[model samples]
Target: MTKQIFKPRGQNTTRAIAANVFSLCFPLFLVDAVRRVHPVALQQFHLLPPDGADLAPGLLEDDPRIVIASAWIDLTDGPVVLHLPHTHGRHFDLTLIDTAGEPFASLGTRTDNDDGVDVAVVGPRWSGEVPHTHLARRAPSDACWAVSRIHAHSPLDRPEAEAVSRNQHVSSLGRRAEHRTDHVTSLEPPAVSSLRQVIELGPAVFFHRLDSVLDRAPIGFERSVRPLIDQFRRDLDGPPPVSSWSPDLAEALELGFADGLAAIRAATAAISESRGIGWHAVAVPQHDESGASLAQAGRAYSSLGAPAREELLTLVCEHDGHGRPLRGDRSSRLRFPPDGLPPVRGFWRLHTRPTASGDKRHGIGDRNDLSPDDDGALSLIIHDLPPAPGDLGNWLSAPHGEMCLIMRLYAPRGEALSGAWRMPPIEIVDLDVDGSRPGGASSESLKPNRRTPS
Candidate 1:
């Protein structure tokens, strides 16, 4: 008998991605997210209240505009019922993602349902009848996540958002169980549980973790690659197992893992930039090819659980209007023409992230306080330090080296989604201490998994 040799896969994402790399790379990040998924009380969301706002700067991507109520659910026990109280017209959305990292379904204001309804989520193996009071939501995997988002515009709307968040909850039918969603706070160090930690587990040890997380039969395009995973596992389980792998085979697997990681970290997926401002406006969870799993896993590591595209269209700006990479050391200005605010039924916000710089400060000021200038143009300045004294509330902050800005439209109108409307861009200006501005490459070296325009 002879051992099978694993063929070498393409290392470049610009070229065709190797099938084997897709199979191995896609599941690695999902297992990372699943490991952190825990249940929270029904209708209760984890957040820092207004008074505790000082502590929020330490958290990663902590958007104060929305309250999150999420949980890790499994159908092996039985079907579960998700309770959603009426929103009373405040924006809210709930997305259901399977263990394979696919977003299967979404519900909320985007779905045209302000009046709340109970949703019964069942797995493929489930054979029970959903009670007439609930809408049946069948999941691809037995293990899934119920991620809910409630609109909260800080100090004013936060109390109401918290109230609405408490009305949304998840309950399992078996054992009449009520799963608990984990409590997330700013006090905990993210490195201890971040998915990035799994990136260095190495192929052999990494595959074992992926195996434990494939709790349900693979579905969708994942089914096509399931055979390869099973064969690899069986090979390892046989007489020699991990020790039996030839050096050539071990090296090939290691390269495949690295290649897949590159694809994920780069977010090499096709991005249609809105007005070429380097803002990626994506309708996520595209399930056309095997790459869907890769995308889902990438989002899990970067975005985690975002609302459905219809309810919220998130635009991320990595570079400036000229397609030049945004630099934190250089100050910039973003000007919106008079009466040109983003049109939305719910609300809009521009979150300026001054990432993990030396000061480690985050966004300051709210989008609500923005007003037009004397000339009828609304200009917001971006800099590492306050542009002016006492007017800090009007400016945006940027990281010391790199820059990122997220613009969100809750309940966006038709024009915003269609090509009819486009957002203004950020232009780098002369604001260094020497008053000299320098321009360089088209992009920065940041490799966050968030998708960006090609």
Candidate 2:
């Protein structure tokens, strides 16, 4: 035959190589797509204040706290769509507190069923007579729309059924009002508009409605989102110039992606390890006359860089002769003059728990009985056995050999970071013996505990 056919050489090999490259590039494309779409989706439904109203603070820190006095959520429509964009699996804790920060009263559960325990509603009054309402106490979901200011004493219908029936009622009212003969007759229910307002506004609107009650914005979104804006700007404009896309740039892109993935994995691991594991303390002794200046200490600590940073628990002991370096002991009690208290800002909380070793002979109170100082500083005694009347504040029942103290500073003020704020050291004041109390060992007399660089 006259025709010679030429078969391409390395066809399978070329195809295999192409497939591998595609596999690598495909994930990059997907990640970029996700990143682009996610922010857009979040922004689309971001809650905004009503026409002339001011924006409320978003959630702050991990634990979002808000104070609401009184407000009405107007769902102008009968049915509302509450979109919980950020809340994937977590439930919401919707609680109403009195002006004095006390729980108003027990309202029925927000969700009809107890399938989710994250979201809940607390009001002055909630009874079982209301339709589709549960009295069980639990949390609510991210997205929940409900009729606010419902007369707690009034017999209610099932929440879901009522929500539906309320829609019908509104429609009936509109029709009746259209044909009303007497101007004196009231054709519509008084609470209907308020309930409808909630339905029409959706989740974003509902959040804003609650924010109006406080005359402030939601705190969560502000903290989380504002940081990202700065980060994005820095990424786009700061430092080295961003390179343009090219076939030759693929290698660099892949390497950068690998580095980012590694960072994400490291962060995830660190978060997992730190949860409820106990406290970490970082102490930097001051030398200058101005004890308020943190410049020297801050620079010194920052020079050591991120690894040396310590997550402050709380200030246990301040200016007492309790000593420079604290001695380790088994007792849970602490004795200090009120004047030498550590400087704290915002809110501070203390927790007492047994050491990891699970020894019950130590002194420290369990979670229930932490006594705060006269100024809201936590003051309690530590002892193996229960303390006498004089040592009432000293009962810290910890394990026998060793224990720890955790101090949480929420919304720390500038002094906390600046050298201006100094946390007093925790000194071991006493330990329990065979049916008697013994004074605390001195830091010098006690065995030297190794000081790890924080």
Whose lDDT is greatest here? 1
- Model 2 earns a TM-score of 0.28
Task: Please list all clashing residue pairs in model 1, or write none if there are none.
Answer: 39-180, 39-181, 40-180, 40-181, 42-169, 43-165, 43-166, 43-168, 43-169
lDDT of 2: 0.27
lDDT of 2 by residue, 1-454 (tens): 1111111135232222222222222211221211222232121111111110111111111111111111111122222222111222221122222211112222212232113221123222223221232233211111111211111111232232222212211111112212111211111222322212322332223222322232211122223322432343243232122244343333433443333333323433343222232223333221222111112222221111111112222333312233332222333334334453433332344433333232232223222354444454444543333444444444444334443454545334556656455444344443222333223322222221223213
lDDT of 1: 0.56
Best by TM-score: 1
Q: Against the unseen true structure, what C-alpha lDDT does each candidate score?
A: 0.56, 0.27
Please, what are the lDDT tens digits per residue for candidate 1 over residues 146-183?
Answer: 76767664546766877777666567653334533333
Compute each candidate's TM-score over C-alphas.
Answer: 0.69, 0.28
| Angstrom error at residue 335, model 2 | 5.2
